[model samples]
Target: MKISARSVAATLRDPGAWRIVLLHGEDAGLIRERATQAAQVITPDLDDPFRVAILGRDAHDRMVEECTALSLVGGRRVVWVREGRDGLTGLVKECLATRTDTLLIIEAPGLESRSKLRALLEKAKDCAVIACYPEEGRALEASIRQMLSEQGVQIDPDALSWFAERASPDRAATRAEVEKLFLFAGQGGRLTHEDVQACIGDAASVSLEDAAFAAMVGDRTGADLAIERAMNTDRMNPIGAARALLSHIHRLRRVRLAMDAGQGRAEAMSALWPQVFFKRTEAFGRAVAIWSADALMQAAVWTQQLELACKQTGSPDIVLCKRHVARLAAQARIMARQR
Candidate 1:
C-alpha cells in the first residue's frame, strides 16, 4: 500500500511480502537511495548477474519477460526497473499479477497525483508505494543525525543545527556534506560546532547564522557586524532575517523550558532542532542560566512583532530590523550582567 520515506527502512525488513515496490518522489536522490536499499534487501550482491536483473534503457518489455522467468541461480530473484515512467504501467501490472519469485523494484521521478504506476501500486494488496518528498526543519535534521550515527559519528548539537540549516534539499548533497564532516572529524572523533563553521561556511548564509548566534549570546558588536554583512553583502531581506531570528529564539525558548522542567542543560539543548552550536555550548549554558524561560518567551514575541513590522506599510523596514536586533543584543547584555 502507501508508505512514507520515514518508514521505508522498516518496510525493507520483510520486503518479500511485497511483489512490486514503487519508489517515486520529487527528490530523485532519495528515490535512488531507497531503491538501492531495497535492492540490497532482496539480494546481498548488487552486481550478481543471475539473481538480479537490471533493466536497461527502453527495456520495459524485457523487464516483464525477466520478472516471469525462473531464476537460473536458484534463490529469490530481483527484477529492478530503473528510470521508471508511465510507459511501463502495462508491463508492471502484468508482472505483478503473474510473477511470484521476482521482487520488482521501480525507481521513478516525480509522479503526479493521478500517475497510473503510482496509483496501481497503491491500490495493489501485494505492492508498496513510497513517497519521497523533500524533508525540511527537524525532520531533515533527524535524518542527518541518524545517517551520521549509523557511521559511528556523533555531531555536536550546535554544529549539527548549523550544518542542518545549511544542508541542501538534495539527499545526495546532504550526504556529501555529512561525509565531509565525517572525514574532517576522523574515525571515532566527535564533530564540534567549530568544525561545521570551518567546513560548511562557503555560502553567504553563514553570516545569518552568525548573526542569530551573536544575538542570542549578547554580542552586540558581533551581531551588528554580521547583520550588516548579511544585508549589504548577501542582500538578504529584512523580513527573511527577522524570520530566521525568530526561529532561533523560539528554539531557545523550547530548550529553556525543557531545562526548567528538570532536564539537564546538555539534555535540553540537544533536544532542540538546529541545536545549540558546539562552540557556543558554554555560552549557551550561560544564556540558559542568565535568562529564564519567561524571558525567552518574551523574546520570541518581540521577534515576531519585528517580523510583522518589516512586512507592514510605511515603516522603514531596514531601520526597524536594525533597532529590533539591537534591542535583542541589549537584552542579552543585561541578562548576562545580572547573572
Candidate 2:
C-alpha cells in the first residue's frame, strides 16, 4: 500500500505484514538509504552472506532464485534489488503473491509517480511504496534539528537558520555536512552561526539565491557574477539555476496573492511554508510591495518556460538560462522605474 508521509519512518523501521517494499524518488541518496533501512529490519548486518542478497539491475534469474530460496541462516531473507526499473514489476508482483519469507526491497530512484512498478506497489495490498523525496523548508530544518539533538549537540536559532539555508537539497550531501558538523561540535557542544560557517560553509547555494535576487532587483552586473558562480559548480547546474529564478517568482507570487486577498504584510509572510530565508525577508518585503499579482504571475510563466527550454535534448542550458535571467532583469528595471 502507499505509505503516507507521516508513517514512512515507522513503516520502514518495521514493514509488518508487507511482503515487498518499494522506495522510489528523485533523490537517489534518500532512496538508497531508505532501502538499506528496510533491509536492516530483516538482517542486522546488510552484508550477511546467507540472509541478505544484493543484486544488480535486471538480474531476472538471480532475483527469482533468491526470492524463492530459503535462507541458510535460519531467518527471513532480504533481497535488495538496486537500480530497479519497470522490467521488475511482473517479478515483484509474482513474489508478492507467493508466501515467501523474504522481504523484497527495491530501489528505484528515478521512478515517476505514474511508473508502472511504483503504481503497482502503491496499490497492492501486500506491498509498501515509500516516496523518498528530499525534505525542504521547515521539514528539512526539523530534520537537521532532530539529527543534531540525537547527537547531543545544540544549535542556536541563528545558526540553524543559516545552515539550513545553505544545506544541500540531496540527502547524502546534507548528511555528510551534518556529520562534519557533529564532529566539529563534539558531544554536548553548542553550534553558533560562526561555528557552523567555519565547519560547513557552502557558498554555491548562497550564490544561487543571490543570483535570483539580483535578477529580480535589476542588478545586471551582480546577477551576471552571481549566476556564473552559482552554475557549473560541483553543487549546482544549469537546470538548478533556472529553478532558482522560478522559485523566486513563485514565492513572490504567493505573497502578492495573499496581499491582494487583503492580508497585512506580516500575515501574508506567515503563510510561507518553508518561511522566507530570515536574512532575505526584508528584501522580499520590498519586492512584494513593488510587484503586482499579475506581473508576478507573468514572471512565473516566463521562468517556467525558461526551465522547460533548458530541459530539451542538447540544449545550451547555461546560455539560455543567462539570457532568460537578463530578460527578467530588464523587466525588473522597467517595473521599478514605473513604481
The candidate scoring highest on TM-score is 2
Per-residue lDDT tens digits for candidate 2, residues 1-339, read 898999888898786557889888888878887887788878789878899898996475478778888987698988889989888877877787777878888888888777899888878887898888888877888989988998899998878878886777788888888889999999999999889978877566678788888778777788888888877579877777777788888988898888889999988997886567677788788778778889888988887888898899999988988888788778888888999
lDDT of 1 by residue, 230-305 (tens): 8785548889888888877777777788887899988988877656556667866766776788898898888889
Candidate 1 achieves a global lDDT of 0.81
Model 2, residue 206: what's the lDDT? 70
Q: Compared to the true structure, candidate 2 yields what TM-score?
A: 0.72
Regions more than 4 Å wrong, model 2: 93-99, 111-125, 156-169, 192-199, 208-246, 253-257, 287-339
Residue 150 in model 1: lDDT = 76
**All candidates: TM-score:** 0.66, 0.72
Candidate 1 lDDT at 205 equals 65
